[model samples]
Target: MKNIIITGTSRGIGYELAWQFADAGHNVLAISRKTPQTLLGNKNITCLSVDLSDETEMEKVDNFLSHSWKTVDIIIHNAGSLLLKPFSETSQEDFENIYKVNVFGVANLTRACLPYLQKGSHVVTISSMGGIQGSLKFAGLAAYSSSKGAVITLSELLAEEYKEKGVSFNVLALGAVQTEMLQEAFPGYEAPITAKEMADYIFDFALTGNKYYNGKVLQVSSTNP
Candidate 1:
């Protein structure tokens, strides 16, 4: 059983990932701004209420790791913000808010957990297809897409920096998964993939990705143009 930490577990993909991992007999530490009702009674799951964008609140993760876990086998950075607006209408505050949760928050949490990450551990950050160059692009998502682009780059750089340590870092640039976030971003749109399906794939990848991948941004999309 591995010790896994997942952020943004209150709903959608993160919540499903936490459930799947715990059901598979792993020790799961779930972090989110609000606690999910479904995870309240699970023995294998420990929930931490935290706002990833808040450095002071994120310190609680360090404290939890110091007392509860010695080695982290997997860390999935899934917390993010989606700010959809035309570039010309996007406000500075919108950009900052999106970056805070999607980019800076991931950096801060990963930095805090570095000391506890053991050899052969995996770190996966969820990006978006919109962030990939030459892929299908959409308007009104400047801040969200740019933040994910930063996440992809950050994952690659960290993988290079930690190559010798045996810690693998990768990013999953996901397509439109059926979730509240997707609906909010693209109302009345139908996504081919579901959050539970994405969670299953991510759970499997987190378990074995180090064997075949590192420092790479893999796109998880099912859209055809």
Candidate 2:
């Protein structure tokens, strides 16, 4: 069984992904700020209540890997911080806070796991369609969209840096999904996709997409919104 690490497992797509990976007979490390009770008794899963933006908290992942895992097969950077506010009303702190989780946290966490990532390992980052340049843009997402875009670029760079080593890095720019984060960004609007549905796609991609592509961003959207 492959050893996989997933972030943002407290709810939405990450929550569903944790259980799905475990059910598939993989060893899963589920990390989020709040641990989910659903993962409590699973033998295939290890749940960690962690703050991604905190450097100290992320070190625990390294510790766990050193103690129990042979090597990491996959890492899904699913933890995200969303801030929806009009540009004029958004404060500097609000913007920085979003970057802390969406950008800095991604960099720090990836760096921490690199020692355990060998050839054939995949690093999949979950981005948003809003982050894509020239894609549809929405108001009230200045901080959120910008941060997502940064991560997309980050993944591409990592893929380039690790090409010789055969590690793969890719980004999935997802469209509107009916998630709590979506509700915060746009209330009263139903999305074409559900959290579990999106998780299903990610699960498959995390497992095998690296064989076909690496250092690329796949736009996983069927709708404009």
TM-score of the candidate numbered 2? Answer: 0.98
- 61-166, model 1: which lDDT tens digit per residue? 9889999898899999998889878899988998999999999999999999999987899999999998898877788888999899999999999999999999
The Cα RMSD of model 2 versus the native structure comes to: 0.9
Where does candidate 2 stray beyond 4 Å? none
Tens digit per residue, CA lDDT, model 2, 126-206? 999989999989888999999999999999999999999999999999998899988976789899999999999999999
Q: Which candidate is the best by lDDT?
A: 2
TM-score against native, each model: 0.98, 0.98
* Residue 31 Cα positional deviation in candidate 1, in Å, after optimal superposition: 0.7
lDDT of 2: 0.94
